[model samples]
Target: MMRALCLTGDPVADKLLTDDPFALLTGMLLDQQFAMELAFAGPQKIATRMDGFSITKIAESDIEEFVELCVTKPAIHRYGGSMGRRVHELALHVVENYDGDTEGIWTAGRPKPDGPEVLKRLKALPGFGEQKAKIFLALLGKQRGVQPKGWREAAGAYGDRGSRRSIADVIDAKTLVEVRAFKKAAKAAAKAG
Candidate 1:
């Protein structure tokens, strides 16, 4: 069910995970304290802030004003009281520590430098937590092996009714069967050898 609803594969959303480092980081900053749909709005609001977010502009902006800008929508959908301020601080922190170079986040020596690493880095930012990091990574492609952890428990816990557990109860059931058969065959072949 998750795979089915996500069939077209969410490519545009996937790019947020690894392709464009700056945008991904920006989205992560905006993601804090909002729903999945709302958190994504942070990046969209930022494009007009400068000439394609040239980095210098964000670093130079009066974060207080930028935070006010972040208060407009998605970020404001939930506990939006101070979302603007949060976004402002996040951007400033990025610029201050990374020299506005968002991609430097991947140092090449840590934990395979994969999607999870990206999540780890983003989570390290202020205002970003586990859920924010996971949602941000979800936009990437679900490829980084990052998944919404509470989804299953939420379903059973609240009877979420939306759990699709009925449908996706066993993802790749056929594939699992095939894998088991392959393992059996390989084991037999090895024993015979």
Candidate 2:
């Protein structure tokens, strides 16, 4: 069963995230230099503006047009132009690598990839880096139930049970506040160090 996500406050946006793997991935990709709720809301904007969201459609879209859609009023992110390009590249990667199945990054292969392998695959995505990939892996294991062996270890600190570290741990308004507080404190500590 697919668990509902409350990353975006908007019910429509949150529903999209819960029902669409690519949307969730796109949300994670956009979850940078932006507020978490709005970042996760981006896919719904794209879906509404484009009439629908499809991996192949996005991948094959004209770059200029897609960027324009992304940078429209209430843009997907503060840096909509760059993020739009990144999203396009991500769609292309998904189509080429996983035949447009976002879940295949973790669920593919004969033996079914373990947690580390899934992390490796996620890290290879266009906008995903080390921490982002790990957080996303943790999100999958914790909320989306994509756990493979060693998942907790592979996710590093983000996988800690009952932790309020990242989006992986965000389940409601209260948890969102907790995560924000945690991130703020961590940022302060990093600066003080």
Candidate 3:
């Protein structure tokens, strides 16, 4: 069994993330320009509104209707419409490439993929840039037990042990605060320089 994610304080949202690989990926895709916990909870909101979460359903959904779903009330992100489209595109990419097996990105192929290979696969996904790919790889290694050889190196700074640098290090409320602090400091330092 996969370990439960504590990204969102809400039990339902966190449970959805834990139970669904696609949901976890969606959350990571939504993590940009939004509060991390709320971003992670976006999948749960979609699951609730749509009656269940399915990557196929999301990919096949009418773009306008899907945008509406994302824009409804609380919304999936601050920029709901754009993020919704990105989510749709991500679903399509995964379906077309992995045949709906989200884990296949890491677990597929002869002799199994190593960390660099998995990172390359993640970088190919829609909305996953180099930094985002590295962070997700770190999350998989630290929490989801998707560690492949050289995972730590592929993940860069985010994979360092006990480092509260990104969502990968957030195991609880305390860690979330630590990550936020780290980001805030980094942003401040960048501005200062």
Stretches of model 3 off by over 4 angstroms after superposition: none
Winner by TM-score between candidate 2 and candidate 1: 2
Which pairs clash (backbone N, Cα, C closer than 3 Å) in model 2?
A: none
Q: Model 3 over residues 40-157: C-alpha lDDT tens digits?
A: 9999999988989999999999999999999998999999999999999999999999999999999999989999999999999999999999999999999999899999999999
Poorest 10 consecutive residues by lDDT, candidate 1: 162-171
lDDT of 3 at 66: 95
Better of 2 and 3 by TM-score: 2
What is candidate 3's CA lDDT for residue 23?
A: 98
Question: Order of all candidates by TM-score, from best down to worst?
Answer: 2, 3, 1
Relative to the true structure, candidate 3 reaches a TM of 0.98
Deviation in angstroms for 15 in model 2? 0.7
Per-residue alpha-carbon lDDT of model 1 for 38-146, expressed as tens digits? 3444454455444454456665778766665555554433645476566556667778877777655544343445655656776787777775554444533332232
Model 3's number of clashes is 0
**How far out, in Å, is residue 70 in model 3?**
0.4
TM-scores for every predicted model: 0.50, 0.98, 0.98
